[model samples]
Target chain A: MTKLLLKKLTKTFERRVIFKDINLEWNGPGLFGIAGPNGSGKSTLVKVVTGLISATAGEITIETDGKKLSPSTAIDYIGFASPYLTLYDEFTAKENLEFAVNIRGQQLDEAKMDQLLEHFSLLKRKNDFVKAYSSGMKQRLKIIFAFIHNPDMIILDEPTANLDAEGKQKVYDLVKQTAKEKMVIFATNEEEELAMCDEIIKILSYQPAGRN
Target chain B: MFRRALWLFNKDLTSELRTRYAINALAMFIIVTISVIMFAIGQETISAALAGGLLWVVIFFSAMSGLSRAFVSEEERGTSLLLQLVASPTVVLTGKLFYNLILVFAMNMVILVLYSALFDAFVLKNVYIFFFSFVLGNTGLAFASTIIASIIAKANSKGTLYPVLSFPILLPLLLMLVEITKRCSEGVKFEDIAPEFFALVSYNVVIAAVSYMLFDFIWKE
Candidate 1:
C-alpha cells in the first residue's frame, strides 16, 4: 500500500495564485479524484504531486511500509499519463513502450504488453509509428504506457480526452481493476471520471485558508 | 544507470536516423563552411598555425549547429515531461552526452579528412598528438554542449541562447585544441606537446565532472 500526504500545498505562477493552503492525504486502494474546471490548476496539481514541477511552498511525501519516499525518487513508483506528456513520434508503438520500460528500469513484460495492446485494440497497429496514430489512438497509447509497469501509483491527467466510447470504457475498467491494490489518482473536470473515485478534492475549495 | 543511458542514446540515434534533423544541420554547415574556406584560400600558402586555427574554427561552428538539438527536440515534442518522469536526470544527461560525442567525432573526422586533402599546408607531423587532442577536445566540447543544451531547452530564446552561452565556455578549450594541432602541423613530437595534452585532458575532466553535478538541477528545473 502507498500513502501520499500533501501539507499546506501552495502553487503560484508569477503573480497569479493557482491553489493555496491545500492539505490532503490518500492511503489508497481505490480511485481518488482531483476535480476542477478548465485552467483551474488540475494539471499543475498533478505535476506537483508527481514531482514534475515544484510547489512554491509545502511538502509532498510518499510513504510505503513506514518508509518515506523522497520527491526525487517518487517517479520510480509512479506512473503518469497526460496529454502534455507525449511519446516519441518517430518510434513505433512497441518501440515507445520499450523506451519507457527501459527508462523506468522495469523488465519488459512482453506478455502483459501484448495483452494490454489487445485490450486497447492497438495490437494490429503496434508496428506503426506513433506519428500515424489518431488523437484518440495516441491517447490510448499514453494510457497503455502508464499502466505497463503496474506501478504503485497511477496518475492520469485528463485520462479520457480524445477517447471514443469504447476506449473510455477500457480505461475505466483498467482504473477500477488497478485501484484495487494500488494508488490511483485522476485529475479531470469530467464528473463521470470523478464519480468513479472514492473521494473528490475540489480545487475551488482550496482557496487560501487564513492566508497560510 | 549506464544501461538506461545507453537506451536513451539508442533512442536518440534511431530517431536521428529516421528524421536526420541534427545530421542534416551538421552536414550542411560543415560542407558550406569548408567550401567557402577552400574558395577563399585557393592559392594562398597558409602557415600551419593558421591552418590549425582554421580547422578548430570549422569544428567549433559545426558543433554549434548540431549539438543544440540535443534537448531542444524533447522540449519541442513534449517528450521532456515524460522523460523527466521516467528517467533520472543523470541518465538523460549521459545519453545526450554520448550522442553529442558521437556526432562531434564523426563530423570532426570528415572535416579533418577534407581539410587535409584540400589544403596542402595542413600536414600533421605528429599523428599521435593530433589524435589525442582531437579526441579529448571533442569530449570536452560534447560535455559542455550537452549541459548548455539542457539549460537553454527551457529558455524562451532557445536558438539565440545556445551559441551565445556556448561561446564563452568553449573558448579556452578551443584555444588549447588549436595550439596542440598547430604543434602537430609543425612536426612537433608528442613529448613537446605534453603541456597542451595535459591541459586538454584536465579541461575535459573538469567540464565532465562539473556538468554531471550541475545537470540534475538544470534538468529538473
Candidate 2:
C-alpha cells in the first residue's frame, strides 16, 4: 500500500500564485481525482506531486510498505503520464517501452510488454514506429509507459484528452483494475472520470482570495 | 546509474541513426567550413598558428550547430518531461554528456584529419601531444556544450541563443585548445606543452564537476 501526504503545499509562477496552502492525505488502494476548471492549477499540482516541478512551499511525502522515500528517489516510485509527455517517435512501440523500462534501471519483461500491448489492442502495431501511430494510439502507448514499471503510484494529467470513446474505456478499465493494487490519481475535467474518484481535490478551494 | 545512462545513450543512438539530424548538421558544417577555408586561402601559404586557430573555430561553430540538438530535440519533441519523470537529473546529464562525447570526438577526429591533409602547414610532428590535446579538448567541449545545450533548450529564441550562450562559456577551453594545436603543429615536445595540457585537464575537470552540479538546477527548472 502507498500513502501520500501534502502539507501546506503552494505553487507560484513569477508573481501569480497558482495554488496556496493545499493539503491532502491520500492512502490508496483506490482512485483520487483533481478537478478544476481550465488553468485552475490542476496540472500544476500534478507536476508538484510527481516532482516534475518543485513546490514553492511545504512538502510532499510518499511511503510504500511503511518505508519513506526521500525527495530525490521519490520519482522512481511514481508513474506519471501527461499530455505534454511523449515517446521517442523514432522507435517502435515495443522499443519505446523497452527504453522506458531500461532507463528506470529495470529490464523489460517481453511477456508483460506483450500482454500490455495486447490488452490495449496495440498488439498488431507493436512493431510500428510511434510516429506512425494515431493520436489515440500514441496516448495508449503513453499509458503503457506509465504502467509498465508498476510504480507505487500512477498519476495521469488530462488522461483522456486525445482518446475516442473506446480508447477511453481501455484506459478507464486499466486505471480501475490498477487502483486495486496501486494509488491512482487523475487530474481531469471530464465528468465521467471525476465520478470514478473516491476523493476529489478541487483547485478552487485552494485558490488565493482574489484569483478565484 | 551507468546502466541507466547507457540505456539513454543507446536510445539516443537509435534515434540519431534514424533521423540523422546531428550527424547531418555536423558533416554539412565541417564540409562547408573546410571548403570555404580552402577557397579563401587559395594559393597563399598559411602559418601553423592560423591553421590551428581556424581548426577549432570550425569545430566551435560546428558544435554550436550540432550538439545543441542533444537537449534541444527533447525539449522540442516534448519528451523532456518523460525523461525527467523516468530518470534523475544526474543520469540525464551523464547520458547526454556521453553521447555528446562520442559525437564531438568523432567529429573532431574527422575534422583534424581533413584539416591536416588540406592545410599542409599544420603537420603534427608530435602525435602524442596532439592525441592528448584531442582527447582532453573533446571531453571539455562535450562537457561544456551539453550543459549549455540544456540551458538554451529552455530559452525563447533557441537558435540565436545557442552560440551566444556557448561562446562565452567555451572561450577559455577554446583558447587553450588553440594554443595546444599550434604547439603540436610546430613539433614541440610533449613536456613543452605541459602547462597547456594541465590547463586543458583543469578546464575539463572543473567544467565536468560544475556541469554535474549545475545541471540539476537547469534540468528541473
Candidate 3:
C-alpha cells in the first residue's frame, strides 16, 4: 500500500513560484531518493510531505492500516529529520530520547535508547549536553530521535551533510537497515548517497510547455 | 496533553538545573535592578504604588532575558527541530510555555521577596488575594513571552526585537498586574480587586488561545 501520496503539490514564497504541480508517492519498505541540485525545493518538498508546511494547492494523503490519515492524524506514523531541525542542546542524549518517547505517549525504553546511542557511536557522550556535541554528533542524535519511536515512514534531508567517513557509513547503514521495515525517503544531492537508493526521482527545472 | 507539557517542563527544569544560566541571570538582574531602584528612591516614602510598579518592571526585563535564552540552548544544539518534529506544534508550544512559566514564576517569587525586603513593605495581608494576583501576573508573563519568543526565534537581532514586540502588547496586562498587586499590598479585599483580576485572567486566556492557534503558522515559517 502507498504510505504517502502527494498530488499537484505547489508552493510559493514571496510571490515566486518555488515548485508547482509536483506529484510524488511512496509505498512501504523501500528506499526512495529525491535527487536534486541546490534551490530545487528538495527540503521544501520534504517539509510539505511531512505536513511541516502547507502546500499552496494540492492534496497529501497518508495511508495506514487501510485508512487515509488527515494532516493532524498523519503525524503519528511519520518521523522526519533535517539539519535545519535539531534536539534541545541542554538535554542529555538520554533525556532527549525520553522526551521524544513521552510525546508519543509511550514509556521510555532505556534499553532501546542506549542501543541507539551505541549504534550511532554516541554511547560515550550520551550523558553530555548536545551543545557540547560535534556537528556530526548533533546530526546523528537528530536522526536517532526521529527513529526512536520506529515510525512507519522516515523522511531525512541531507542525512550525511556534516559527517566524516565513519559517520557517513553509519548513516548509510542505518538507512539501509531502516528500509527493510519502513519506507525511507532520503533527499540529497550526493551521488554516493543516491547510489544506494532502490528508486530515484530527479526534480526537473521549470520549462515552459504547452498547457494541457 | 498535560503529560506532554510536563515532559517538556521537566526537560527544561532538568537542563536549567544543570547549567543554572537562565535562573542565575534573572536573579542577578532582579537584584541589581532592585538595588538601583532603592538608591534612586533613597528612603523617601517609597509608596506602595511605586513599589508594585518597580517589582513588575524588574520581572518584565529579567524575564525577557531569561525567556530568550530558554530556546537558545535548544536552537544552538539543533534540538529545536527535533522538538518540533517529535511533537505537534501545539504540544511543543505547551511544553515550552509550561517550562517558561516555571522559570518566570520562580523569578517572580524571588523578585517579590526581594522587593518586599528592600522596600520594607508587608504586602501579604490577604494571602489569597496576593496569590491570585501572582498567578494572573505570571500567566500573562508566560503567555506573552511564549509568543514573543517564537517571533524572535528566527530573527537575527532578537535582542532588540524581543522587548519591542513584547512590551507594547504586554503593557495593559502589566498595568492591570501592578494595579492589583498595589491594591493587595494595601490590604484591599478580593472583591475590591476582582475586576482587574478578571481582566488579567481574560487577557491571559485570550493571548494563550491566540498564540496556540498561531504557533503552527510561525513554527512552519
Candidate 4:
C-alpha cells in the first residue's frame, strides 16, 4: 500500500550536508528499524519523514485509500514519539490522553481509555500528574497518547532508551501487536531491539581519509 | 480548531493554578514599580495626563515577564514537541495567546486598582475608551510575545533574548496605547479618542494576522 515514500531527499545545516539523494519507502504493515551511530542523521531522517522539518530538496508523499495525501492532511494519520518528547506534567494520564483525542476532533470514551491504561499497567496512576510518575511510566503514557487516535503510521525514536526489562517487553509486545495493522518505524542503535524488526536500514557517515 | 485552542488554554490554566509563579511575580513587580513612581512624583499633583502612560508601562513589563514564559515552560518540560505533533500550529498559538490575554487582562485590572490607590488617580470616566485601550494593548503584547517566544525557544539564552526581540516590534502599539489612555484618563469622550483607538485596533489586527500566518513556519523547527 506504500503508506509513505520519500524521493531524493536532501538536507543540510550550516553548509554541511547531512544526507543527499536519499530515498525510502514503506509499503505495508511491518516493523522497520533505522540504525546508526550518533551524528549519523538518523534523527534528521525521522524528522523529515514526519514533516517536522522540510528537506532542502525532495518530495514526501503519503498514500491512503489509493489517494495521495498532502503534508498537512497526512499529519492526522501519523503518530510520533521520541525520548526527548514529554506529556504535560500537570495533566493526569487520562487528561493527557483526552487532550490528544480532543485535538484530533475525537471524543474520549472512558471505557476504552481505561482499557488502554490497564494495558499499560497505568490504571492505578491514571489520575496522577505525569510529573509524579517515574520516567518509564511517562514513556508508557507517551506511547498511549501517540496511539490513542489509531494513527496508521507510528514513528518512534530511541523508544527503549530508558526502559527496564519489563517495560521493554511491554513496548516490544505493543509494537508487534500494532504491526498487524500499522507500519512501525523505530530508530535506535541497540542490537537487541533490532531483533524485532522486519527490516533494518543502516546509515553510514562519509569521512575523508586522515581527516580525523 | 477552537477545541484545540480550548485544550491548550486548559492545559496552561491547570499548570498556572498549580504554580502561580507568573502572576505572583508580575503582581509584586507592578506593586513595587508603581510605588517607586508614586515616590518620584510625590506632591506633584499627578495628572490624568500621565496616568495612561504609567499604567501601560507597568502592564507591558509585567506582561513581558509573564507572557514570555508561556512557551518556554512548554520547552523546558519537553512537552512542546508533543504539542506540535498533536495540534496544528495555529491552534497552539491561538491557545497560548488567549491564555496570555486573560492573564494580562487580569494584571491590567490589578494595575488599575493599584495605580488609583498609590497615586490617587481619578476613576476613568470614559469607561469604554479605557477598556478599548486595554484590549488593544494586550492583543499587541500577546501577538508579539507568541511570535518572539517561537523564535527564541531554540536559543540557549531565551530569558534575555525574548524582550530584546519583542520590544522593537511592539513600540508602535505602546505609543498608540499611551495616546488612547491619555485621552481616556482625562475624562474625554470616546469620540475624542476614536482616531487613536481605531489606529490601535488596526495595529493589533494587522500584527495578529501576520503572526498567525507565520506561526506554523516559525514553530516548525
Q: Cα lDDT for residue B142, model 1?
A: 89
- Clash pairs, candidate 3, are A86-B78, A86-B79, A86-B81, A86-B82, A87-B78, A87-B79, A88-B79
Clash pairs for candidate 1: none
Q: Which ten residues in a row have the lowest lDDT in candidate 3 chain A?
A: A203-212
True contacts kept of each: 0.80, 0.90, 0.66, 0.62
Give a tens-digit lDDT track for model 2, residues B174-221.
Answer: 999889888887889877888888989999999999998898889898
TM-score per candidate, chains pooled: 0.96, 0.97, 0.89, 0.93
- The lDDT per prediction is 0.89, 0.90, 0.81, 0.81
- Candidate 3 DockQ category? medium
Tens-digit lDDT string for candidate 1 (B1-221): 88888999999999999999899999999999999998999888898889889999999888889898989999988889888988888888989989999998898999999888888878888898788888999899989999899999999999889999999999999999988888888889878778888888999889999998998778876
Cα lDDT tens digits, model 3, A1-212, are 44777799888876767778988777878899998888888898888888877888988888876788777656767888788886676677787788788876778777888888898899999989878998999889988877888788888999987888998898888889989888888899999888888888787654446734
Off by over 4 Å in 4: A207-212
**Residue range with the least summed lDDT across 10 consecutive positions in model 2 chain A:** A203-212
Task: Write down the worst ten-residue block by lDDT for model 2 chain B.
Answer: B121-130
Question: How do the residues A1-212 of candidate 1 rate in per-residue lDDT, one tens digit apiece?
Answer: 88989999999988788998789999987899999888788899999998888899998988866779886677778899987779999999999998888776778898999999999999999999999999999999999999887788999999999998999999999899999999899999887999999988998734445875
RMSD of 3: 2.9
Q: Pick the candidate with the highest DockQ.
A: 2
Task: Give the higher-lDDT candidate: 1 or 4.
Answer: 1
- Model 1 CA deviation exceeding 4 Å by range: A205-212
